[model samples]
Target: MAGSSLMKSRFESFICDANESVAIQLVCSDNELDNEPHNHAIKEFNPEFSHQLFGDNESIFGYSDLRVKLYYSSAKLNCFLSIGFTDKVTKDETNGIEADDVVDTIRQKLSLKLCSSMDEFRSLLSKESQFIPYGKLMDSFSIDWKTDEKQTKRHFEIYSADILVPGFDAYHQRMQTFLWWLIDAASYIDADDERWQYFVVYEKRSPNGLSNGHLHSDAHNTYCFVGYATVYRYYAYPQRIRPRISQFLVLPPFQKCGLGTRLLHTIYDFYVTDTAVFDITVEDPSDNFTRVRDFVDSKNCQKLNAFSVDKLKLGWNEDMATEAQTRLKINKRQARRVYEILRFRCTDRSNADEYKAFRLGVKQRLNAPNQKQILDYQKLEKLKKFPEQELAFIRQTTIPALEVRLDLLDKQYKELEEEYQHIVERLAES
Candidate 1:
């Protein structure tokens, strides 16, 4: 039967019929039902659970009982739960398992755990297939970046310098949303001035067009660069700098293909060789950045400091700094190391230390008579260098009045203390 032409033809016909019928049913059912209900059910199955179980081949189906059967009838495959026990099963209706049968079994098993609509089931199956072996698929579909570098430049212009171009606002906004989805979190990508300055690589369509669909889109086409160093500058000097990058986004359909790597390499190459950007810094560790980090490392790009702007910003607050100092032991040596890594110069280390000590001392002396003197001295020193107009304004302000009252109170208390000291001395003499 396996070798017979008639049997082979019949089997082929059955497969074609089953595929067409099932495809039609799935499409029709998908349109009728909403996927949201099943999404919540699937969420119960931890998003990472599939990754753990399947290890890339996440598309799985299972059944509760082995009695469930799948059959291809009238060119369409259908699943049914066994109704009753039978003494003997007929040869024509033999209980056999196929690949599809296994899938059906897994689906049934999943359905028992969650209330999933037909649409949701279909959607899940489709998505499951997409992510399964995505890395392998990407590797298989890899494109040579060098082969396309010149072609890409000739066919599609690659910009090494930061150009002032229009219509980037829309692209940047779109890319922000796309990157957020890819990274699995909402992150702002600012294109402010300071950040824009460091963005070296950019791409736009030439008068002709790109050979690859990944390079240029018919609707919206722009490319931008993003690195850790660029982000750090923005965070550090938010008031002084604006962020900038190419607006080109790697769409969902285009991802997992080597296009992402190619684009990134193209940009990197442009920076290193074409643009002469010697020092390139990426925020994420090589392992975490995945392909981008790998490409950079392959290119012999050096890894700089592992600086986190959020940590530096946290160090700005006194309480937070104290807490961090206590928890992390951010002493003078650590502070100096951080400053050296960040390239910040401390001109007056002793003065800064003294100021810190003075502040702490003032806090300790809050109830003392000299508290007024300490406060007045600090305030007067701060105001002494002010311009004439500012000094006059300060004199007119309530600050001056408060200072005068505090000074008078301090002098009167001092006079009383002196008199008391004289009386003590006279008593001692007697």
Candidate 2:
């Protein structure tokens, strides 16, 4: 028992949490790279995943103060990976459990050139000036930036699908390597596929530090990635294409600063303008992304005549969905959601009749699926003649069912109203 306890305690010293052990930094300038990367990691953050790179335990044994520093040149995303530890448990000290192959495992996940040393990565970073963004400049805007001391307007640009340009896929891959560090379920998309498209946001970074205004000149603009979204244009059978957002992330250094919202708004504009596109969709969006999407869609719909205060109070209408689809490319399901949000914004909460009408309108839409199911049942051949016995049975079943559904509807409506209220509150703030 004494020996067993000693062995367990000894192995515990070897165990290191992979999530904490790994560190990522976006190196924004040459000065940052010239110095030791370990100390000056600009906005250091840990990856959401360690298992995908480290293994089942999501830990690296045999090391203490184990920090796997992964640095990248902010503009070019030139990768520099270094595995450091204060101590390493050796074969002589352990009872067979081995240290995880930390370096090799991470290298396999990234296809880009992995510079093993700071000097080598900095050598590649020197050529950043030649790295022009591949796609047509889609949009550029300046935002007010603030820190502990002062405030200045920072500039950013969004580019449409870089993979479409010949020979530029390498740069796109370098950019995507950041996703693995941020997105929990991140995976590479087939850049070769025509169906996959990308929208990337790059900050016109000043090598000195984030400085004011459009780069002293467009000719002198040095870009670093802020965030990006992957869109897959799926074929809608006979004609038209539906673009679904597969991945989205505004790096930890830049989130909560409206960069995600800006990127999403720009992508929406990209699809809404494309005549071949049907409607925008998302593949398993996180709750955070859904809120951003809701805000953007609702904001856009509010500008349309069909979703105006007058129309929203009149309740949900086909014209609301129709205009949203035709003018903005919002699908009916999403349009209905946008309608509810906009209606909540316009709802007269103080008036009893107005509030009741609003609830009834929302409840009607919520009950739509159940109503359709009943209509579908009535279409059965045996029930078509409306037999008295069957009618009686349906009535009997429906009374309780309706009661259950009503209770459910109220609960659902309350939840929806709460969500819409949050979105509306955000809309006001934004």
Candidate 3:
């Protein structure tokens, strides 16, 4: 007990030192290390150095000078620390150490045995009990689904924004670090703001009922972290609430497992079921997110009576638009997009007559503005100095202009058709 306390004090002191750290490394007890002692040849410390020593999402892909190695037990909370020169600057003279001597000069520090495993490490770092469920009860709020790769079940849960602010805990703080790794120009959240909501996906595991040689039946179930998203609820004019997804991330390990689509669908389900929500929205969605949303929205709309293939053939109408907004919480513009994509999915591309009909249907929507321009030109043609020649010139320029616009629209339709085809294939699997 005395030794554990001493280790905790040492670890805290090391963290408080505010030394010029370059990078940090973590290893389990099973990891091998050289027996050579750490040399302390270079001692200059910079207090303001925070050069994202961890790689993009903790991969150590970027440049970093100093390195901190964390050694922990494989399944226990035991951890030891050491400061070393990263491989990037092992020989750089700006750091005031000879290339080969840097590794020899590194120093070892405090060792801590607080929690067990990486999951427990995150639990300790979280400030709110709701965000970090370890050692806490949270059986009622979880939703589970199976992953495509491992075929293993994963769970997701929603939490109010209050749990992330003011005095954020260690686990939440650590998880927040992922934003820097995954997002561009990312910043930490204002925990005091009640407008944010979080959705987290994790792997649920049963507890072994044993802790440090003691058995406790009430030990909370373990939730191995996967990914999470942040959402902000805005009060639109009138009685509408617009929930914008501020951030969405799926860790690299879980990518391509259909988890992203599942997460998106789950979030939609949450909002669609709410009585106060006006329409769902997204904040600066990436191209990848836009595609996923296209698929999810299209699939859901297909189940509605208003978006049937027969209705889709008749094209987007007030009834289809209204049902999408009221039943699916989709905005009008996006609802129209989904309607077109679904319509293209049912199009018979191999049949020349059917294909021509599909093309004409899309072209008609694209021609509306061009048709208006032609009418305006016709009205002004009679007033020109040489009405006959001016009218001829206008016809010459306008017809080709319309053709160019149609060409561009055709390209857009083809690209959208390909995307819709992919979505349809995925839907078939589901």
| Clash tally, candidates in order | 18, 0, 19
Instruction: Pick the TM-score winner.
Output: 2
lDDT (10s digit) by residue, model 1, range 131-162: 11100111112232233324222122223222
Ranking by lDDT: 2, 3, 1
RMSD of each: 25.1, 4.1, 12.8
Q: Which residue runs does candidate 3 get wrong by more than 4 Å?
A: 1-161, 164-173, 207-220, 363-404
Candidate 1 lDDT (Cα, whole model)?
0.31
Question: How high is the lDDT of residue 201 in model 1?
Answer: 21
Candidate 3: worst-modelled 10 consecutive residues by lDDT: 103-112
Better of 1 and 2 by lDDT: 2
- Which tens-of-lDDT digit does each residue in 140-208 have in candidate 3? 223233334333233343332335444333444445544543565566776457687766665433343
- Model 2 lDDT tens row, 53-138: 76767788788889898888877788888988888887777856567777877887887678877788877777876667767788
Better of 1 and 3 by lDDT: 3
